[model samples]
Target: MDVIVETRYGKVLGREEEGVRTFLGIPYARAPQGERRFLPPEPVEPWTGVLDARAYGPICPQVANPLNPVDGFAQSEDCLRLCVYAPAEGTGHPVMVWIHGGAYVFGSGQSPWYDGRAFARDGVVLVTLNYRLGPLGFLHLAHLGGEAYASSGNAGILDQIAALTFVRDTIEAFGGDPNRVTVAGESAGAWSVGTLLVTEAARGLFQQAILQSGIPFQYRTPESAEWFTAQLLDALGLSPSSWRRLFDVPAADLVSAAARIPARDGLNLRPVLDGVTLTQSFWDALRDGHAAHVPTLAGSNREELMLWVARESEWRALSDEERIARVDRMWGPLTDRARDYYVDGRTGDELLTWLVRFASMRTFTYPTIRAAEIQSEYAPVYLYRFDYRPSRLGAAHALEIPFVFGTYAHPSARALIGERPTHADVSDAMHAAWVAFVRSGSPQAPNLPEWPTYDPKRRSTLIFDEAPRVEDDPDSAERELWSDMTSLSM
Candidate 1:
């Protein structure tokens, strides 16, 4: 049977299945086309009749990821939409809004891996949303375009805030509590959650956050952003002074030009430190305890960088000396001490494994630990390490998502965790912990150990493995090795 609900914009017709009601492809903001392209998101106009929301919306325009391919979803510019899943019979349920991750380049709320029925089954209303991606969403042309495009660099994030605003205003009709919204995501999505923490516009829209496998890092200064802008303009044969020409270029042409930018140039399109939208660095806001005072749960996999390392042929083929030299170049004076602490006597594949592990710590783990340390000063922060090592892949990047969503049997889990059988008990534990954290401020899963709040004194963290346990200051020596560095080379 079709389920009809009234949003602030108009009536939306959804569908119900197995005790969960799902409303899909509901626009939260106006389509960014014509005059709206590259500008901050604006509210959707009220409609005259019921909007059919039974299908997932078109994903944001971008080239498909070769590493992680998403098939069967239409892509378009009019993709600023969100999906909702709520229990068939509930009132004022805690809401969990999910932002999908793809390095801010690809992915969408409609990705099959993010199905929210499990969350609905657990009494939490789950929402997954789509935002703009690539140059269309993040390219910084504000200085050249003037005040009219001041927020161009952060248009994607502005899309997210608009979606949250829609949720805060309209979720109650779907049996959700506007006051108990928990925003969460992984990878770039987690980056977005962290960004929202410091963004003035996102304040009070969410009451808590869950950052899975991500931390704050460099946002472009206008100078650096303009450097990228120059590169893009050069790619398109348009001069900087002729920046207005960008508005007329076909979206496909823009995406094609963006894809040609070499990854090694460190030219990943990202949010910029716009003086208006993002006035200060996320690190500064976090360090000064200026972040929203909400309970937070932050964590990363035990071997995050391995996902990339496993794909890089040259990195996998590095000789011990080459690996050591590379580590030295990245870690500075701490290289030798870190090797002694983490890789001393190991050789061959074991040595390679250790090398990858250290790289993961330097690039992913330490940053998350630093974020937790800073965030804990202002709010209760729970830290965790996903330690379940699958047979083929270790506890690598994004390996925890399926487990968190309780969708370990999904085909997408194969690319991440291999064909090995998933342990239901582990998924039960992790998903329950997420539910507990969303419902209350604490992660109190029955199958897992008591997760304590993180503080610099104890540096406590929950280790999620077959047998979950709590450890204090886990991997303390390696963490200390890079303590003096300002940021990781992410």
Candidate 2:
């Protein structure tokens, strides 16, 4: 059935399946092309007639990775669009906005893994959105563009804010409650959720947050951003003085140039501390209780780094001595303590797997713990750790996404989680908890036990495995070793 709803911009024709009404490719903001490129997102221009929002919009421009491919999606500069899924009968359902993760480079709202039909079936309105990516989104070019591009570095984040604003003003027409919105995501998207908590521009945009497999602190300073921008210009054959020519450079050329810049070059083109759009450090803001006082659910997967390690052939073949040197270089003075905790008696593949697990703790798990600790000071924070090991790969990064979205049966999911029978029980428990959090501030659901809130003393964390259980200070020994380390590395 075709359903037509009148939005602020104009009438949008959506399609209905079962009891869910889906409206895809709705322009939340104006097309970010030509003059609007790299600038703060502008409000969508009012339309004349009903807009056919049946198909997914073009995804943000990025270099495609064949290894981790996003199948059957168009890409273009006019990619600042969002999708909405709501129950056909509900008038005031809670809204859950999802920001897809792709290391701030790839991924989009159109990813099949992020389908919102399941959420609609559960009586929640699900909204998925796309923001600028890569150099076009996060490049720090304010030093060259000056006043016209002060918020250039954070253009992607600003796009999210704009989408939320549109939802606030217009989602009520789509059977959603503007005042009852929860923002959620995994990895880079989760990082955005954390960043939004402390962002003044996103002050009243959401009522709660859910961060999965993400770090709350990962922003480059202005000095570092300037250095990265200089290198990027060099890669594009533009000198510092000719930096303004970047606006004229083709988007494809810019993306290619960005992809060529090595990771070791210190050219991190992620979010930046621009001293404007992002005024303060996210960590400092959270610690000082400057973040939103809304309830939060933050967690990461066990063996989170194994996914990356599984892709690296050279790292898998490293000698014991080489592994020790790599660990020392990465962990600094904590190498001995970490080795004793993780790789003391292991050898070969077992040793490498343990090393990857330790790296996961340092990079993803510990940072999430710190975030929960800081957030608990101001509001109720629930912490969790996903331990449901798949067939080949363990509970690695992004492994919990399908379970949370109730899309475990998806073909894409089968690649990550083998062809074995899907874990329907775990999916029900996890998805219910997510829906519970969106509707009410707590993640407590009937499918799971009474989950307690997190605190510094107990550090109660829910471990999601075949038999899920709550454990207080799980992995306490390893966590204690990093207690003195004030900051977490990305």
TM-score for all predictions? 0.94, 0.96
Q: How much does each candidate deviate from the true structure in C-alpha RMSD?
A: 2.3, 1.9
lDDT of 2 at 49: 80
Summarize candidate 1's per-residue lDDT along 74-160 as a digit string, tens digits.
888999999999999979999999999888888898877789999999999999999999998899978898998899998999999
Question: lDDT scores for all predictions?
Answer: 0.86, 0.86
- Error in Å for residue 145 of model 2: 1.4
List runs of model 2 lying over 4 Å from the truth.
265-267, 324-334, 343-345, 486-490
Q: Report the C-alpha lDDT of model 2 over 119-169, residue by residue, as the tens digit.
A: 999999999999999988988878888988888999999999999999998
**Candidate of highest TM-score:** 2
Give the clashing pairs for model 1. Answer: none
